[model samples]
Target: MLGRVLGGISTSLFFATFECWMVAEHRRCGFGEELLRYMFGLMFSVQYLAAIGAGLVAQAAASVVPLTRLSASSSWHYGGYTAPFDISLACLLLAIPAIQMSWTENYGNNKAGAAGTGIAASLRAGARAMGSSWQVPILGLAVATFEGSMYCFVFNWTPALDAGGGLPPPHGLIFSSFMMACMCGSSFFGMLDSSYRPVKVLLPVILTAAAALGLTALSLARGSTSNGAVFAGFLIFEACVGAYFPCVGTVKSEVVPEEARAGVYNVYRVPLNAFVIFLLLTDISPATQFGACCCLLSVAAGAVWLLGRVEQTR
Candidate 1:
């Protein structure tokens, strides 16, 4: 219990600190940032795609024939559990020089101003500024809910498949396929014309995602759908997940005032982190949780559609 609590806090703090700053830095790029941002998104997708694909192959091969360069005993081996981390640490060490060479002056310091005296005061002021516009909070809520659902899927999809769909362990095939689909999704969205507004594009994507989630939930609950069908449904949903980062970033740049962007972004994380933790703690069946996600996605779709209509007026 204590470990879970600490893990959640540590995860939340790391994301709130690092992720928010990353977004802020992207925003500071000024012109053509959307293209750059989504390009970065595409790079991220490719990175994961390759990593997941490699991991799938390695794990599958290890399952068939365990590799043991260093072994405590016959049953204990290095390949499956320990070798990956060693490789990762080695890669991290190798990248340090490149990372140092690429480092730039902190862009966040430029955004920081005397909005208030301290962190608390700055948060209060940012909140007040955001509250002055209803759209800010509404958009924040919608994005948070949407992002939270994606995170839930990230954490639970494998277990859900194993327990409810009769899928077994070592889900490399499914994971890699999803990552590949995500890569295609991100690339497609990144290439779309800039004439289209972010909110307008998101409305339909959100609706499609909700429909996919609903189908997936039904498949999980009834077991009428084949594994292929379940996988297809999730692939479609993963495409939407890929587009979501760029779309929400576009909306944030448009709707959020410049001064409060960082604070409001962190504020949005509150509901997202909260929802994820709630779902994590729950003992409900996977099908039931997926059904709940369908409902939540439906609401989020409606909210984003309304937000789009309002954005048209502005």
Candidate 2:
């Protein structure tokens, strides 16, 4: 129970802290918004590489202390597969010094700011901020549907890969490949952003994502067991996942006020969380679930389309 609680806190912090810091730090240093897009794309690309590296490191650590049922999925190793946890602790401790050396502490809104004082007030301020701005809610809708679809993919991929009745698909290798695709995606975003605005970049990405998901869902619905085709579709969506983070981050930095950034940003997660639960909780088949995902992404694409229209009018 305690470990789960601690893990949940860790997950929340991981999602929230570094991105907030990046935005705040960027503004503090007086960097151009042009540069901000580059930084976000670069950050995600490197972050994806680091995640791959961390997986390699964890696997190496697990080898030194092998588990009873070890194959490809070394991540789930138990019975004193504790080496990764130790490494995690050491890395976290190392980050303390890294933060001290590289980061300067900054504050958000003061007591008199729009975010006000106290958690309750901050949350209320976030709600108001989200409602007040068309951009914020549209962005929130994108996060809910797009991010929710990403989570659905995560849940579905294992059963997806294993369906072909072969040597139980190399789970670890597949995960690493997915990460590499995401890395490519972030780099792709950087290149595209150099020529086009993030808003412009997002519309096609969302539409392509919807198309890819629609294909995947249609394949499953038709009972096609062609693993290669389905896997390709899955990879396409994963690539879209990579592009999504930086694009959303760049736009979010523009729309959400810094004083209420964290609060309003966290608000996006509320619908996102509910979206995931609703999708995953149903008793539907993978085809149905993925069809639902495709529908959701279509909605997100519409929202982004409207956002683009509004941006043009502005």
Clash count for candidate 1 is: 0
lDDT (10s digit) by residue, model 2, range 218-312: 88778776788788988898788889888988888888888777778677778887988898888777877888888989999888888888888
lDDT of 2 at 282: 87
Residue pairs clashing in model 2 are none
Give the clashing pairs for model 1.
none
Q: What is the C-alpha lDDT of each candidate?
A: 0.70, 0.80
| Candidate 1 segments exceeding 4 Å error | 1-30, 33-54, 57-78, 81-86, 91-97, 108-126, 164-169
lDDT of 1 by residue, 25-122 (tens): 66576546556556546655676677666667656655654567555655756665455555656766976787578755343544355443455754
Top candidate when judged by lDDT against the true structure: 2
| Per-candidate count of clashing residue pairs (backbone under 3 Å) | 0, 0
Return the TM-score for candidate 2, rounded to 2 decimals. Answer: 0.87
Candidate 2 wrong stretches, greater than 4 Å: 1-4, 58-66, 69-90, 108-116, 193-195
